[model samples]
Target: MQGQHIPTDAQKDEAALWHVKRAGGSMSVAQEGEFDAWINADPGNRLAYDQMRVLWAQVEEPARRMSTAMAGEKPRFDKVRQWFSPGRAFAGVAGAVAVGACVFFFNPDMVENIRADIVTENETVTDVTLTDGSIVHLAANSAIATDFADGRRDVELLRGQAFFEVTHRNGDRFRVHAGPAMIEVVGTRFNVDYLSRNTEIAVEEGAVRVSSNDNPQGVLLGAGDRVAVSTAASLGDVEKTDPTAIHGWMQGRLSVRNVTVGDLVARLDNFASGRLVALGDVSERTISGSFPTTDVVGSLETVAAAVGAKVIRTSPWLTVIY
Candidate 1:
């Protein structure tokens, strides 16, 4: 029952009392009402509230003095009232000093506390094997972050795509985070395509739960299933597709299925040295085919031939079609 007695309303009241006093006075009517309601709603609220109050008291004086200096006002006991005002006090001393101290003191800690791996645009595909014996094929222009703390392994997909061949590790959950959605799995082979506007999760081996960051109860996907989370909307649509086609990137192929011609061209441009442009009437066209990943020029040619579009190589870094 250790977790059962979390916190209570009376404890939160006591904490709020301290916070208001440290802020130079008691809570306003609106704040007091809000605090009371919050405490009454949860049993553990009071304990958590008291802890926060203690933290505030520890940092209150330094935060206040720092705020005063930034506002061009001398730090005095009388002017302490200025630190309690809405915009001037909070913005000037409390916020500035706290943030500045964090930036100055905690920067090194922050850098050392990084929980992810990154691959830049100029970098090639990197191979990483997780502690669970799962292999991650991280594509170029992609990054994966993993926090192996707190008895869980959480990997975040910052950009691009990655093919995961996960090893079966019982009791250990592997989660992939892309945008506002998180793909959770115990042990499964999957491909996460996280382009600029489209976030696609395709499962090949085991079942995976694809849930929105905003609403975790929305949807779940199984093996041989794909879910597309759009950047514009919160609703995600699921579809059944060939898992091989989705995993074709591992074999140096860019597979497409009814994708926009513009999107296909963009994919080609990522691997190729020059920019690939779609001419008039080609941007709106839909393309369905597979292109080789290693051969960017060949992919462009294949796409151009399929769409009857011309690929004019303007420069090494730029190209135009018309």
Candidate 2:
């Protein structure tokens, strides 16, 4: 039997149609005909359209209200709009006030001057070269804020992981801000993985200064060293290890050392080709192995066999363990 090919095109069309219909614009006869033809082209398209249509109906009012606000119009207090509008939901003036708050919170100079790469929820691995010839490899669910117009080059990693290969330049320092911890470097190659709870830094060459955003207490890390910062405790810890083993994900390898099963499953879900689930008492169990990010199922099976656990392939992209 042939394996199923995921309907990416159909899903994309469904999403596009949802946005079009939500904007409250009528499609031309030719356009509608073309849309119908496209939908009927495949059974999966119809199914995807149906699902998106349901979701469109649920958020139609809010979407319209947001559009109206963006257009700078006095929003109507229709019964449907009232339930979805930000004003009624959060006091009478909260919505407008929140917009002002956002403006104040975001630095005007930074917002206007900086050229930022904004990655949406679904986009994975956005790569960009900075003005100073530095290459930034942004991971999935990540964003980088930087300004190239200024004489100096600075980037703030809002969330997720990024690999930086900075070019050597005189009087230019490349800086990365991950949560409260800041990393400063010059002409270096390194990786920074900053999730919600943990901040990790591995230096491949040159050197980096890892410091807290709130204070001056930090440590300078050399090549082949790693540091982790815990946000919950606001403390930093350093360890000397093989940088390639920890930072191999940039090269398509998922390396883990004494990592818990729960953590492994979470990490695999981000970059793996399959959905990995841990069953039974595997949450507390630890795993120490290296695997390729391409073959998640094979890697999971190998790990499971090594640990004497059962590997159940629920589907092509879904796996359950026991």
Q: Quick one: best TM-score, which candidate?
A: 1
Which pairs in model 1 have colliding backbones? 7-43, 7-44, 67-92, 67-93, 116-145
**For residues 78-184, what per-residue lDDT tens digits would candidate 1 score against the true structure?**
22222333432122223212332332222322332254465534225678887767788887556678777776778888767898887767667788888777888
- TM-score, one value per model: 0.60, 0.56
How displaced is residue 279 in candidate 2, in Å?
A: 5.3
Task: List residue ranges in candidate 2 displaced over 4 A.
Answer: 1-127, 195-197, 279-281, 311-318
The TM-score of candidate 1 is 0.60
**Highest lDDT, which number?**
1
Please give the range of 10 consecutive residues that has the lowest summed lDDT in model 2: 89-98
